[model samples]
Target: MAQGAALGCLTIASLVVARWGGPAVLGEYALLRVLPWLTGVIASAGLPVASTFFLAARTGSDPRLRPTLLTLALAGSAVGLLAWAVAVPLLHRLFFPDLSPGLLLLAGLTVATQLFTVWGKACCQGQADMLGANIVIVGEELLFLPAYWLVSHAGLHGITAVVVAMVGGGAAATALSVGRLAATGFFTGRAAPSLRLAREVVVFGARAQLGNLLWLVNLRLDFLILDALAGPAVLGIYAVASKFAELMRLPATAANYVLYPRFARAERVDTDAEVRRLLPRALALTALATPVLALAATIALPLLYGQAFRGAVLPACVLLVGLAVEGASAVASAYLWGIGRPGANSFAMGLGVVVTVALDLVLIPHHGAMGAAASSSAAYLATSAVLVGLTYRFSSTGRVSTVVASRAEPL
Candidate 1:
């Protein structure tokens, strides 16, 4: 809860920067922000999912999981480096052609930053202290805000500096948190790295990475398309709206942190009964979160960003509907992935990503930011539907199946 509150505060400060900065600056900052998260998602892969289950299991019985966690981190780090080498140049030319060499260098650091931070967070979560994981998150935000403010005050060169700060902060925080965990003697076991366990974690992580990509595409493909079709300013508007929407999901995000490991433990105990007990409460929570978000986006958009941002209102509203769907889907996703159905989650996100790209091509050129919003919203809705359907079919409980069949049949 402290972490969540800190995040909420940090999120507000971020919005202040975005709101004050307006479209072009916000667009640039958005690019900076998205890169690390995208890389982090890739680096962490399915380990977050693996962490919840594996960690819960380890805490309960096996203490030999530390080496497995270390091995997974090393593997992810290697992959991250490779990904940075191949992906960053292409991405820079595509999304940030005017970027300075300094910003480019800073962006490169994201590969390492995401690798260490996400791996450590997953490890900590496995150790049942998600608070430690979130400390890194909030700490990064805290570091970036002030760092960027000071640097930008010095000169416009501040943007690159801010990016560097973010990367550095994540690395530092992760190191500290993980070191503290290690000092507790949790990772002192002389366990060998299990090829078998590594394979299982990597396989799941890879499958989950597919969904991660889809989510990446789903979340940002629209911005990329909008940037190409309309311009950065419009992308900026959508970016601001998207930031607020992320703020709205804080509750659901917090809940998932609590729920994933719990759900994982439950599945290990009895999959069917766990789903039966968890699904309704999850949906009910989603139900509660959606309208509050819609309301927040509605009220907060103008108030925070000023009348200049009134244009984001309609797009924000449209995006909130998509978020509502995604929220509901997240509940199901938590359970599905918890029970080891990452492939299903990946497949659903893949289909949704394809749909989003198709729609962006058709719609963004014609409609601009709002078009992007609609495309993204539709994609999330479809993705949510796919996840719910898959969860219902796969869940051992007739409960999820019945819920999908009766109340929320796919539209």
Candidate 2:
């Protein structure tokens, strides 16, 4: 709840900044805000999933895996930095053709912030410490809202301030989390006992990371395609539409956070039952929530983005349906990962990405944001179907376990 409120506050703050700073500034803000997500994903190196599973499995029990967790964090950070370096030139050419020199510096700073912050959060998640992670998130929101508010007053440079706050807060959280881990001897310089464990961890982490990358692209593909083919003005409308659609998931945010650990733990034991019980509940909730939120979005966007955005209503509605499919897919994905089959999950997401891109290519040049939504809706629905089928086939084979039987209850 606090997390959701914090996000709401940040959204409000950004909107205010947009109102004050004007649409052009808002466009810049949006770009700055969205671009770093790609870098953040690379920086975390899928440790969030691995660490959660690793820590939950050990927690009060095993002390040996601590070093491994620490090792992975460091490794993931390094990978993120490397990825940022590789991506900067390409992104600069694509998004900011006349990129300022200092912009690169700001991007570096943002990447640094994201790497440390996510590393810490992953560690806490591994330990099943959602409270600690949420505290860090709250801190980020508390800091960022005020920082953005003040930075908006500074004109163009204020955007830099927004970026800095993100990095600084993340760095602070990561440092604190890692410090605590070290104090607990979790990061002691110890030799990895077996090459097999390291290989398994890396393979799992990489596959999960790939799936995450695909997800990142899939979620933002509509906007990117719109911006590329339709123009900045249309991209702006699509962004607002996407935001409205994303708001529908607000209710499930808490459940989403809690579900990861549950899935991870379930997969550790009877993976199949865990998925079978969880998938339907997630799907039902998403289906129930979609239309209500879509109606709300249709009503809200005109009010929020002003009359200029009235055209986005239908696109928002389309995206809302896509978000529902994504919600169901999200739950089923947990089951896939739970059962040590992240590769299948990755393939599912990869397929969605391919489909979305193809649809965008075929439809966006002529149809604009509406076409993008169509692509997203079609692709995500297919992805959800694939994920559910794979999860059930893989995880629902054994005799009805107690946990599995209990999960038959619908939402």
Candidate 3:
């Protein structure tokens, strides 16, 4: 609930953008986000997932683990910033030629800030510290409005202001996350950076990120295609619809943020039962929430995002089908990653991407936003089916027991 409300605050920034800039400007702003967000994920080297895994599995055994992970996160952020410096020029030329290079370059700050922020939160969750994790999550997003308010008053507006506000929010989150992590005395003990541990983290992170990267792109690829074939105005309407549709995914976010580490910690005994136990609850939450949220949005979309955004309602309704399915998929993915079978998720997400591209190619030209919605729904269901099928297979075959946990590479 706190997380959901915090996201609501973040959405207020979008509302401001939509109201002031309309759909075209809004669409452009969304485009600005794709690169930094993608880069941030790349920069993490999957540390958030890996942190939760290693931290939870060895909760009290290793004091050095927290500090070691912290050191690596700092180093990774530096590398990410350097990489962003190199790539932003080319990326701006290719993908965002219509937008300003200066704005894109400025948004690079988010890559480093967001990486450290997420790593800290993931580290907190590693110890089953839900209160601390939730505090960090809520604290970060809740500050978005105040930061935007301050920056807007200081003569920053439009996408530039939003970008700056995002950096501010990220910085705030970094302070909160790192501060909370420190409260646990992460830096008080003697620690050294272990290359062996670093290699293991990178490898695990790479494997875990395969599906994650695919999933992230799957969420955003349609926006690019829609923008190309249609216009920014059309993409903006679609973006509003996408945001509303994703509200149903709060359950998935909860599972990913909280349950993933638990799965990692308990994988030695049984992941199948956890899957069976949580899958139904998460799926049911989506089923119940989608229609209610859709109904609410029908009345609220125009009032909140303005009448220009009324067109988003139909598309949002269409997207609910796939999002409901994605709820199940998220839990299944957590199970796969937690149990070190991330290849299963990679295979599923890869298949979903193919479906997404093929459908976007065929549908967007004809149907526009509705086409994107349909494509997203079909692709989501495709990924969900595969994940659920794999979990069931493992359940029946006792394959999970074969995954012998090693002391060094626990998974």
Top TM-score: which candidate number? 3
Output the TM-score of candidate 1. 0.85
lDDT tens digits, residue span 1-411, model 1: 645666665666557566556566667667766775566557656565565556665333455566776767666666766666667677777777667655675676666665566666666665667667666656655656665566567675535555655666556666665665676565787778767666666666767677777778998988777776676778778887776666546665666666666666653336556655666665566566767777777788778777777788778778877776554576667766666566778888998988898898988888888888899889988888888777667665443432222110111
Backbone clashes in candidate 1 total 1
Give lDDT for model 3.
0.79
Cα RMSDs, all models: 5.3, 5.0, 2.0
| TM-scores for candidates 1 onward, in order | 0.85, 0.84, 0.93
Those runs of model 1 whose alpha carbons end farther than 4 Å from true positions after fitting are: 6-10, 19-21, 40-45, 58-64, 86-88, 153-158, 267-271, 288-292, 396-411
Clashes of each: 1, 3, 0
Position 69, candidate 1: lDDT: 68
> What lDDT is reached at residue 387 by model 2?
83
lDDT of 3 by residue, 366-394 (tens): 99999999999889888889988887676
Reference-based TM-score, model 3:
0.93
The stretch of ten residues in a row with the least summed lDDT in candidate 1 is: 402-411
lDDT for residue 285 in candidate 2, whole number 0-100: 80
Model 1 residue 210 lDDT?
77
Residue 106 in model 2: lDDT = 61
* Residue 126 displacement in candidate 3 (angstroms): 1.0
